[model samples]
Target chain A: MGFFTKLLETSRVKSPWIVHFDCGSCNGCDIEILACLTPIYDVERFGILNIGNPKHADILIVSGTVNHRNAKVLRNVYDQMPEPRAVIAIGACGTSGGIFREAYNVVGGVDKVIPVDVYVPGCPAKPEAIIDGVVLALGKLKEQRTAKDTDSLAAELHQAREFYANRADRQVVE
Target chain B: MSTIIPFGPQHPVLPEPLHLKITLKDEIVTDAIPMLGYVHRGLETLVSIKDLDQMVQVVERVCGICSCIHAHTYCMCVEGILGIEIPKRAEFLRIIWSELHRMHSHLLWLGLLADAFGMESLFMHCWRIRERVMDVMEATAGNRVIISINKVGGVRRDLSPDQLRWIAQVLDELERELDAIKPVLTNDYTVKKRTVGVGVLTKEQAYELGAVGPTLRGSGVAQDVRMTGYGAYKFIDFEPVVEKDGDSYARTMVRFRELYQAIDIVRQLIRKLPDGELSVKVKAAKPEGEIVCRSEQPRGELLYYVKGNGSKFLERVRIRTPTFANVPPLLAMLPGIEMADVPVVALSIDPCISCTER
Candidate 1:
């Protein structure tokens, strides 16, 4: 492996930039997520930056239940992130669809669309649990970036790059 | 030419997904239309499947910030329909939890507003104080955010004298910290620059647009549903915090003053802590009636309507949250304001989209 790739892999575990997306949650999990950034819970000490843009993020932190309408949006966000990205499903709704699982127009957990690496379970998961979940995601992120994982990783990146290139080509043709 | 700029569904200023379509004429906003339903979990419709007791848990999840009050108001509605009177001690406990919820909600709003205008230290300071309230909540009720203390007839838990004393001590410390930071919030140059003379909603406009809570109180209307005397509020003596300016600054002041009001109310409830049974044993008999219940939530007045047939499950449950009522005024206030001030102006109403769309 190249020295730069190894450097990037190790640095990712130390500092993981994450984008938080609320699919269809009661603001409970969302607030708890925000609380983690505040002075008391302050997840920043671990170098976890709450980056707003999905493209700039290394970890995707999703909260709440995924509804039918937002399912596409969630997929688009996941697709926008570069390969080796990890997803942390925070709160019960994001993990297995807590209380609103049976509701009409609800698509259950976030795993319905994208791959989730870590699951933090709570009605609205506490900030402590959320931080722990992110730390867990960082471990998965490091594993995904390892030399042994690159074979399957290269295949997924090839397909994603092709999909983007085809879409760009289509736009130019139009 | 007027161009449209869409904000949110995932903006930093908003915790929940609230989309705003702003039509701007150069630097000024010509019109603003808010589109909701991003966080709608269809909780109200779950009444058909979950029984009335289980539905409290569902209702509590409608908005996590105001979970205690949502459960409190829903239980009040069911109790009203059943005509069951709760014990005196439970009423006092309910008031204590509700006021604590109000303190944390206001502090959360204050911190967010500070963060919106780029006041990082002020945001940190506010949340620091807010943590104290959350600690008291955790020490007493077990959870930090959703206390889940409110039950059908009364409350699920009780506090000992020592715990109550610890709460009073913590509240005293909170008040001292708030005093140190009060000037920064009220008289700071940046806070004043962003909030003062912005988003002015006249009394008539606020009334016509159906604004409620601090949004209504900020407009000089002095209209608080707490004056209606539900729960233990009838026993406590208090008045709504009103500011006549009707600007963003005025709304901010209304919430700022309310933080102290909540503290005072909690103090009063603790002092007059009554002695009795915690909750009356409610029969699991199916309810048959239509009832409307109202309670003063931290954001504003929450109105809950429950229709029950002779079944364990309720037929219908509808909630009209304060944010839903306050959004129209936000739309009215958006135009004629600079594009840069839109976030603070929208936040001035303390919009909670989860509750609004629930």
Candidate 2:
């Protein structure tokens, strides 16, 4: 790899901007995610910013259970992010739907729709655990960057697009 | 020509999924249609699956910010049906926890409002003070956000004498910190310029449209569900915090003052705490009547209608959240404001979309 390319990849790993999406959570995990940005937890000190746009984000932090209505939106957000991105599914709901799993509208966990690299477990995962999950996802992000060649990266992107395209119909069938 | 701009389902300003189709004429708004059901998880429908005793945990998840009040109101509804009067100590304990939840929730909203107006440092300070409340909750109730302390009869946990004293000390510290930030939130030129006279909800409009909580009180309505003296509110000495301006500034002042009011209420409950059993073991009597119970949440007045048919499961559990009642007022307030002020005005009601949708 070129020196500039290596530098960019290292920077992406060191300072990953995150976009947080609440898929049908009770707001427990959502508030905890916000708590991670406050002075006490201060995820920004590690160069992490909780940004709004998915395209500019290096990490996607999802909390809550996937439902039918928001599944398409979640997939759209994931597709918007660039390649070599990481996903951290926080809270019991995001990991495996938590208490709301049995609710009629719930579609289980975040992994049911999009690929997730880290699973942080708690009914509402603690801010500390969410921070840890983000750190773990960063390692996976670096691994994905090192492992994929340009050709392989293009192939993976195409596969992800196809998978997401078919996912809506698959959800309907289920 | 009017333009329809879709706001949210995913927006940085909103914490929950609340979409609004805002119709604007030039720079001013003409109409707004709210699109909900994004955060709906069919929680009320869980009444058929989970038994009445198990339903406490279910209802508590309705809104994470005001989880205790939801559980408390649910228990009160069931206790009314079964005619089981909880012990005095339990009532006081419930009051303490509920007040703490109120304090934390208002703090969270203050931080969000500051962030909405681009006062990033002010937002940080608001949240920094809120962490102490969260710490107190964690120390007393074992969880930070969703502290499930209420059961069917009374609270599941009791405060020891040492913990109570420690909480008192913490409240003193919280009051000092809140005082330090009070001037910036209330008297700051930027905050006033953005909030005062913006999204004015008149007294008649607020009352006729059924605005509740700070939204109602901010419009000079002295109505509060706490005045009904449910639980230990009868024993406590406090009045509803009211403002007369009926604008975003008024609403912000209502919640800001409420933070201090909640701290005061908690202190009173601690001082006048009556000694008794925490709860009474409920007899296995299926609730066979339909009843409605109401409680004051941090957002507004929350109503729960429960119907039982002499079975292990409730026939129906309908929740009328404060946000649902406040939405109409919010819609009414939107038409006259500029597009830039939409978020601040919408946030002034402290809309909890998850609670509304659930």
Candidate 3:
């Protein structure tokens, strides 16, 4: 278990491939994240790559507030990513709900549906903060190196969905 | 019958909310149905309750990348209805920012397109050059990308000689970097193979489907609303970009060529910019009428229709973004293409789902 945990942690720091998903973000944070990947910041230098295929990714960085219509789609995508993965929720919208928290369309925080490794808070967080959040997420990822042994992350995700489902107040999303 | 594939309000390839239900048989798409309104914040309902001035902020927020284009179109519609003449200097500045935005937007799309094709170097190089443009936007305006410099009558800010000089220097440097990439994009066998014959739209098809921007231009039609000579376009001596064949390659080349034209337009605006106040005081009177405004955004033709009552609130507002028009042609093109080429073809029209949904 110790050795397996180290393998996941080592991969988390080396080449952390990220797949970005927007639940209901205002695009401000999404663009900022893109800026970090651009030339000046070039997070790619740190082996951070924005990948398309979920099967190959190690990190799932979600931006925006997860809304009603997209709740299922978001879960499906998170499931498609290979085992030994981490979820990093970026922007205030993802963590709490930002300005749209009270809105009818929003599905509360992302943690309600998926287990989040780290939370990056900002109205629309700066690119530098995003870089730092990924680093922080990597740290959390390393700590859970033996992710396959107990499968705590998967269980956490199931509990999260159940939490949202059990809420009687919400009408739109299950 | 062809095979069917779903592209998305939740696609891995696109950043926007677009659900393209593509029907394909043996690598050809037989039919397509576009699913929209995912990002709809009920903005039109929101507009019905908000004043025209506040609507500008909301409309600008519709699409972060093309925020200025929406503001310009909305303001022009308002100005047209009131019969207000803007300052020449403000007009020039508007064109300068608009074109600079066009450059960065096209470059950003280019980078995404490169990434779609798995060309990491091309993606890196294009994004590297785009940062220079973003720096200029940040230096001039407080924000880097969403430079909220547009106002109702004219503009909200002015440029100093030092700033103008700095803008010119950076613009030239970007122009040089873009020039270096031009030949490679045009001549690269990989790019040509992936895009050249992929999404073909004929001239009549372009007009019939109401394709705007480079998607329209790539079809060999010279129909740029900028030639309508709105703002400073009338003052500057620039020709519209047109390419024949209407393939994905043609659209790609047209954007590459326009980067050069945008730089030239900015240089001319700087050299011949007039002297005057940046903006005039709006009367703040209630707008009570209907107005329609259109512009050539980086994507294509954007249409905005606004209805106002005698109160501060607008009666109704409607927006038809370019991607709406480009989708039909995309459906038409998707059939007969391999699955591997899906990402490039999907991105070819530069999907802006936030704008489309809002």
Candidate 4:
């Protein structure tokens, strides 16, 4: 790898700016995500900061299930992030929709609309578990950088958009 | 020029997903429209999907900050429909846990409030103290955020005298820390300047808008659902904290005083802890009635309506959360405030979007 490429990889690992999105959660996972930033869990120690803007984020942490109303918005957020981005699905709801999967409005988990690299599973997912998920995402980021899989990533994003648009359209039809 | 600025669905000040469309005339907000349904998971509709007995887990997850009280109220409602009386000891245990939940929630809110106003150290201090409350919760109920202890007839777990003593020690430590920080939140000049007279909701306005919890109490309305005394609260003696200022500062003061009130409530519950069964032997009979249950949450009063149809599944379950009730008053507070103070005034109501949309 080139020296500049190596430096860029190391910088991404050192400082992963995260954007947290609440798709349709119970606030269980959302509070736990905030708890990760506080002194006790302090994910910032790992150089992870929760930013509010998707344009500036390298990691996307989503809590809760994706519903028909939010599926397109979630897809739009994923598409806004720059390449080599990793998505971390936090909590059981985000991972597999949890108990809300059967609800009429829900379209299941974050993976329903985007490609999730790390799945942190808990009712709210412990702060420790979330920190571990970020670390795992860093590894995924390195792998994605090495493979230079922008084409496949683009394809995946395209597929996700189409799927959600269809889901929204189906909801309207019903 | 009047400019329309979208405040959120995603914003730094709001930790949750809430969208506000604020129309600005120069620096002052002319009109503010809040758009809901961002985090609507349709949880209330899951009553038919999950059985009545298993629905306690679903209700508890409605909002992590007040999970214990949610479950407590749901179980109380179900027990009411089934006509079963919970043991006195169980009632006291419920109070202790619920009070602990309220303390952690208020501390979390205080930290968020400090962050909203750019007081970083104060935010850290509030969260640092909040961790102690979480530790106490984990020690007693085995989970920090969602203490899934309540069941249909009563609570699921029993605390020993030794565990009770340990919780008391933690509460004592927390009270000392809160006493040290209370002054900074209540009397600090910057806090007062930013909050005082920023979002004044007159007593009449608060009543007409259906504000509950600290939002109502801050407006000089001494009404609290705890006064209804569902559980062991009936035996406890403590007055609701009321401030007549009806601004952001008043709301902060109400929550600050409530921290002590929660601690005192927990202590009283422990001292008056009775001896009996942890839960009654709930009979297996399909409930055939409808009941509405109300409980005081850290944010405000939460109402749950359950309709049973003599089957395992419930007919309908509706939840009216405090944030939903406070949103109208929040809109009323925003129009006259400066653009920069939008977050501070919004945070004052402690809007839990997930709770509101759920």
Candidate 5:
């Protein structure tokens, strides 16, 4: 709705600095993402840079099944990124835990950790779908300017700390 | 000041998840501690529930890039369980497919390493060659990746004469082009400065840490899983590739030589292929026993331990990926290295966190 907001959204669409994280995935999805960055797909031409630091990233691309052990670390990373941030769950495992859902260690899906803006579904979602999901995230970022003004990630992080501190409260009151 | 840095269990650069606590004293690694058990999916459990027929698919999905090798190794284990002899044609095809996967995987590693160092154009060029390998995978397996071609007794897909010839020809081109490109990777001042002499893993250190694949090969060891002669490896002749320097450059050179070796092995396989049944009808029942079979993945030696109950489901499955073996070495090497050199040194072991985690 605002001038700088519109400009930032447009630039974000054109220049998405992505930080890719692997919660726990078979490299199938990781390699496909690598393919998109390579010359054959060349998603980088659109200025989708893979940044090493999470603090500066606008798009968070995650692959693999989120396991119980990594759920906290995943939330912590999602909390670290600045506002106007978007999460793209890449691969079947990331979206819904895929083949490994029934396993004891599997965490079911990435959304269980944080809200996902887009989901690219495939055993190993092809590079093209990954790009499309990113494009969709940018569009959503533009539309959500006035939808929710609060910093949800920070709030979630705060809530998480409380949930852990009062672990005894989870037991039966009776 | 002593600084602590965490690597993986969830981090960039590793497709798998292994938590490494690295301690550095002003850029020199002082000590490294590794924490594992992240991607443990109870693969052994799945193997028991599924018959040999179905487990073939499961093994291939274990790691996408190395799908063919897992399938091949599983096939070897199964053939051992049942007294079945694979046809020479099937054996040749298996070898050809494995080598192609190696070529593609090594190139993928080369590009990522280059990209890590901020060599954008060079990275792009390496991946362009990778596309050719993917094309071959697509043409044969009907999937660019996760080929899913390896089956119980033999391969699921049969290679036509034209496909075989095309594969050999394509590999020839890739070999030539990759050879010409070697100078750029080796001679370039930046790559040398970034990689050479950094992350030096002495031969004894490598052995002590249980390093495998090019990581071990770089440390002056001549060990490779292929020497075990699983699949069609017995028929197709090849030698273990090694470099004595035990630095990042030596590791790079090992991959380079192995790439050419992979090409040659494929060419010989296609030429010597004896025609017959590509896949035999597999009877899957709860076989009573446990077995372990492994092969050299692009990263290193990968072992799959399977324990099967008399029931349809597997009792236990444990995978020891090469990345796990290299972790201790990585921790050892990480200390005494500059912060800037961490990724380069880390990647030199070709970390596949997913495989480790899984």
Candidate 6:
């Protein structure tokens, strides 16, 4: 790999900019996620910045459950982010839909619509846990960037395609 | 020429998902229509599956910022239907937790409002003070945001004397820190410039529009549901914070002043906390009637309606949150404002879309 490419890979882990999207959260996880940016947790000390633009983000941190209306928006956001991006599913709602799973308009977890690299599980998911989840996601992001060979890229595409195909079949059956 | 612009489903200033279809005529807002359902988890409909006791946890998730109040109001509704009175100590404890929640929520709003106006340092300072409240919550209730302590007959947890003393110490520090930032919030030139006279809602307009909480109180109306003497509010001296200007500044001041008021209420509740059981053992008597319960959340008045049919599961559970009432006033405040000031005016209502949609 070129020296410039190696520097880019190292910087992705060194300072990962994250964009948070609230799919259908109770605001508990959303606030906790916000708390990570505050003085107490201070996730920025790790060079992590929470920006709003998905295109400028290296990690997509999503909270709450994925509902019907926001599912499309969530996919749109994920699609907008440049490649080698990582997604962290936050809280009980984002990981497995928590208590609101039985609701009619609910679409369960974030993985129902897009891929997730790390899962942070808590009713609200404390700020510490959220920070840890983001850190873990950065590692996955580094691995993703490194494993960009043709064979690995093709494998990831096939896995993602199969995952969506199975989801479509499940939806049809349901 | 007029053009309609969609102002979010994902905006940096908004902490929750709220979309406003704003119509602009030469940089001035002519009209604004709100679009919701982005965060609707259909929590109210879960009454069919979860039992009455189990519903408390579900109700708490309606809005994470005001989770305790939602659960407290729901429990109050169920208790009213069942004709069960909670213990005095539990009532006081509930008051303490509710006020703590209020303080943190207001601080969170202040930070968000500051962030909205691009005052990043003030935003950080507000949240810095707020961490003390979250720590107290974690130390006492075992959770930061959603401290699920409320139950049907009473509360699930109890506060020890030492814990009470620690909370008092934190409140003292909180007040000191609040005073430090008081001038910047109330008298700072930039804050007033952005907020003052930006979104003026008349007293009549606020009342007629059914605006509740700070939105209504900010408009010179002294209508607070807490005055009806629900929970331990009757046992303690309390007054609603009001501002007459009815602008974004007025609403901001109302919430800002409420932080001090909440600290005072918590102090009073701690002093008068009665020694009794945390919760009563509720019998197998199922609630068999419809009842409405109301409480003052940080945003404003929260109302819960519960119906029971002599079964484990409730017949229906409905919640009318303060944000739901504040939206019309928000729409009213949006017209005639500059496009640049939309974030400040929109955030003044402290819109909780999850609660509004749920």
On lDDT, the candidate that comes out on top is 2
lDDT-superior candidate, 3 or 6: 6
Candidate 1 CAPRI level:
acceptable
Candidate 6 runs further than 4 Å off? A147-174
Q: Could you tell me which residue pairs clash in candidate 6? A: B213-B300
3 or 4, which is superior by DockQ?
Answer: 4
Tens digit per residue, CA lDDT, model 2, B1-358: 7777777888898877788988888889988999888888998888889998889998999989999999999999999998999999999999899999999999999999999999999899989999999999998999999999999888889899999999999999999999999899778998999999999999999999999999999999999999999989999989999999999999999999999999999999999988889899986759989999999999999999999999989999999999999999999999989999999999999999889988
Over B171-247, each residue of candidate 1 has an lDDT whose tens digit, in order, gives 89999998999999767999999999999999999988999999999999998888988988999999899999999
Q: Rank by lDDT, highest first.
A: 2, 6, 4, 1, 5, 3
Model 2 TM-score, all chains together:
0.95
The DockQ-based CAPRI class assigned to model 4 is acceptable
Candidate 4: give the clashing pairs.
none
| Deviating ranges (above 4 Å) for candidate 2 | A147-174
After the best TM-score superposition of candidate 1, give how far the Cα of residue B61 lies from its true spot, in angstroms.
Answer: 0.7
State the weakest 10-residue window (summed lDDT) of model 2 chain B: B1-10
Question: In candidate 4 chain B, where is summed lDDT lowest over 10 consecutive residues?
Answer: B1-10
Task: Give interface RMSD (Å), model 1.
Answer: 5.0
**Chain B TM-score against the true chain B, candidate 6:** 0.99
TM-score, prediction 4: 0.94
The candidate 6 chain A region of ten consecutive residues with least summed lDDT is: A165-174
Q: What is the lDDT of residue B80 in candidate 3?
A: 70
- Superposition error at B50 for model 3 (Å): 3.5
Q: Find the 10 residues in a row with the least total lDDT in model 6 chain B.
A: B1-10
DockQ of each candidate, alpha-carbon based: 0.42, 0.38, 0.21, 0.38, 0.33, 0.37
How high is the CA lDDT of each candidate model? 0.88, 0.91, 0.79, 0.88, 0.80, 0.90
Instruction: Report the poorest 10 consecutive residues by lDDT, candidate 4 chain A.
Output: A165-174
TM-score of predicted structure 6? 0.95
In Å, candidate 6's interface RMSD is 9.5
Model 2 per-residue lDDT at B84: 91
